[model samples]
Target: MKKLLSILSFGVIAFSCQQQTAEETNAPSVSEESLKAHIHVLSSDDFQGRKPFTEGEIKTVNYLADQFKSYGLEPGNGDSYSQEVPMVELTAMPSETMTISGGSEDVVLNVLDDFVAYTERVVEETSLNASELVFAGYGVVAPEYGWNDYEGLDVKGKTVIVLVNDPGFASGDSTFFKGETMTYYGRWTYKFEEAARQGAAGCLIIHETVPAGYPWLVVRNSWSGASLYLDQSGENFQPDVLGWITRDAAIRIFEASGQDMKNYGEMSRSVDFKPFSLGLNATVTVKNKIKRDQSKNVIAKITGTERPDEYVIYSAHWDHLGIGQEIDGDSIYNGAHDNASGTATMLGIAEAMSKMKTKPKRTVVFLAVTAEEQGLLGSKHYAQNPIYPPSQTVANINMDGITAWGPMKDLTVVGYGQSELEDIAEDVAQTQGRYIIPDPDPGKGYFFRSDHFQFAKVGIPALYASGSYEHMTKGVDYIDSLNQIYLNTQYHRPQDEYDPSYWTFDGMALDGNLLMEVGLRVANSEDWPAWKDGSEFKSIRENSMK
Candidate 1:
């Protein structure tokens, strides 16, 4: 059973700090009972995995609105606590005959087992009628690096097969890109976007377990179901087809096309490579079960006493994979750690702030968005259609998956060195007797994985940070193993159900306080925070502010 956060009165928070003096700043006091209550209720079996376009979403959104009202906040969307995000969900049913035939080869790759594909265009039907295939190396065209895979090639209306990750990652060259650490160019999203910009009829990334990070099972589980995309409103440049093919299946397909993975894979890592035809004609006829609906983004705000227009936003995604493919007799993807924890953690901070004696000078928003699991669609929609101007928003502090393990001595900032937020974070962490560290695995490209990236794309400074590295009992090694185990077994699986048996509340509280402190400092100060000088977002920020 889940316990409730210690409310001062029924439906009202009583725990408010008078001032952030030296003593108060040294420790954070987020209620464990409060955190547990939010998590258990949100992740309960009755919620139907908290998926959108279902009963689960209804309960989740209504509950969040009620919570926001109870916490004495104003509805963020003018008089409504909810913002309707329009989306076009497509469930592509790939035929068995979807194949690449040419070079005397007849290869019919099985769906899910060998590849996964979908369309980005807002259409019920999409087809690739034997589109000519081109091997476009890594599909990158970075002018800064003087690298162009499609240097002399015109791939218009042709299907392009690209390698995952950038050249530096493939070659392990320290001087190239960011060495083993993946750059924005290495992400599969970048690959697909680039292909579409290059006028490709279809874009398929060849997936290798190591370079792609997760195994093929992850891809199948994530992309197999009803895929959601922002209604393009008839926008072009998004490819007719976007997908991934497994490494083993890629090897077989390459050999049939009179090539081999070793030769092409090596060639992709070199900057001297040029795009060439694969001698194969790729074909796919997609039948989409289309659904159009609006997902809810539960938003409310604690209006600032003075500068309400200048806002500080707190975000947490509230959507997860609904009922789908069964695994070991379980069907619902609970998403307990993936985001229920994050939602709860954000709520705890809101509750704590509600009872404070002094509100910040700038406004603070509590936004629990939907369809994040569906490719950050909800946040993407919000960024594109923001309630307030992006320039007025000081920062977006996104919490996605708060560490439920025991206490730690360090905080792990995902995008560690991109902004001055890290500097502020370092200052706040020191008082709590915790050091700040970058994500140990930068090669995974986690910085671009969460909803914060959406806000960052629009020039808003965003922060996604977590803790539980140096455990109060065991050390860093122990914490690392626990994270690995969670990813391998429970992440995005039905097994992610809430289990308080061995869960720790102090970690969540501490992380929550750290986030609150970061926001509190930003909200209270007259000085605005910004992206660091050499950061990619620096110019974007400069332009937006101007």
Candidate 2:
């Protein structure tokens, strides 16, 4: 018996030694040249902005597939690296006429400036004629919070007018619902989803640039295009009609009702907030042309040597504003920093992992999702219908809106406290002589906007760290100014086109390296990362593990 025990112990030791040797040999390293090269191709004008459902998407997917093949990545879906994502494109034509009523004075809402409306259903035309308008305050119905904006109100045939952000924002008390941090409740997606659940004929969210963190022009451009949605196999959560009313337009409606819009907006921030009865009504006639279209989720897999069933996913959205109305002379909304940097980094990581001699213990999935700028649709589809079982999936590392200004002394983890993945990132960051910082503006709810949210919703812990505001070389003020300049002048605009003269890709290389290190730590770990305590995803992930 002792002899047999000795032999067993010896076998285990030998196997352990072999595993360590393999890991040491196969660890991936990010190369400066590779990072710059990938970004150059992805941000190139020839790609036409990488908008999905167009010829641009075709080229973009093929380019990724070809790169993955060269990097020795196995096909993510059976024999193909592409996953077909069925989508419906609904285009709401510019409204010819719109009106407001139920007020002491008659009010006419102007198109382009006042409101933007679109149909959720796949229809050629849907009209909201003299629809009853209800002041649905925050438009939220969180049973946990004992809040219901639709309480005792039958909004079946009515257009619900809701406030932007959560009541906490208006309340200004951190004790009330996540303080200034925008909860999922503050998200526009949630507003429309909740409105649909309440059976509203139409949903209109009042837009405040500060709360929305984006201008009305963003809505105009995004909604003006052929809005795409996943062809939900069955009944999905979508409102009958969804739209946004400018703050000024909302004020006009309130003024017509002989009420101050500013005062009502102020009341919306209170905890005991109730839907206001804005003695005002509205009528919308939406003329939309719906068409079925198809897009692809570009996927590539770096097969594991031992734990092939377990996986780590790195993702970024590839689609952007295709060709929008010209801002100046340029028309293509070249989403360079918005996501071109992200997609490029994803490709960069794939290259590094492919060059490694030793394969990771777990499979590494690289996904370049589409239509994130739309509403996180591409990643959402993948989460609902993943190619791999969610149980074996370990974590997701996402990249979006990478910095082009310069490298930072710290890495900002958006949704910083949401997951255990942050610890892994910190360890990696430490190795690079950097540290991790919480999101500078949690009130923005930026954590919920990107593709990572889709995975997080389905129980996969995801990381969203990027270069920070504190530049490694220059001061914070310089970096802030440059970033502000980008936001005001180029971000999401045609001017976002690549400018080699201005962009210092060496900074991108540093970011790509840090991200690559984070992925490596997860790929080699036997334990799966978890959402932090109190995170909504924590319970979901725990259940999924079961």
Q: What digit string (tens of lDDT, one per residue) describes model 2 on residues 376-428?
A: 99999999899988888899999998887766667899988899999987876
Top candidate when judged by TM-score against the true structure: 1
Candidate 1 per-residue lDDT over residues 1-546, each given as its tens digit: 122443223113112221242235332356889999988998888898999898999999998999888989889999999999988888887665569889685888888888888887767789889999898988988887788888888889999999888887757677787777777898988998898888989998998877787877788888876878777776866888888898777787788788766667777877667788988888887778889888889999999988999999999999898788898899998889989999999999888888777787899999999999988888999999999889999999999999888666788888788888888888887766668999877778888889999999988999998885777447789988988888888887888888878787878887888888888889888988899875788898889999
Model 1 C-alpha RMSD to native = 5.3
Residue 218 of model 1 has an lDDT of 80
lDDT of 1 at 254: 82
Backbone clashes per model, in order? 1, 1
TM-score of each: 0.94, 0.93
As a whole number from 0 to 100, the lDDT of residue 460 in candidate 2 is: 91
Worst 10 residues of 1 by lDDT: 10-19
**Candidate 1 pairs with clashing backbones:** 5-34
Q: Which residue pairs does candidate 2 place in steric collision?
A: 26-358
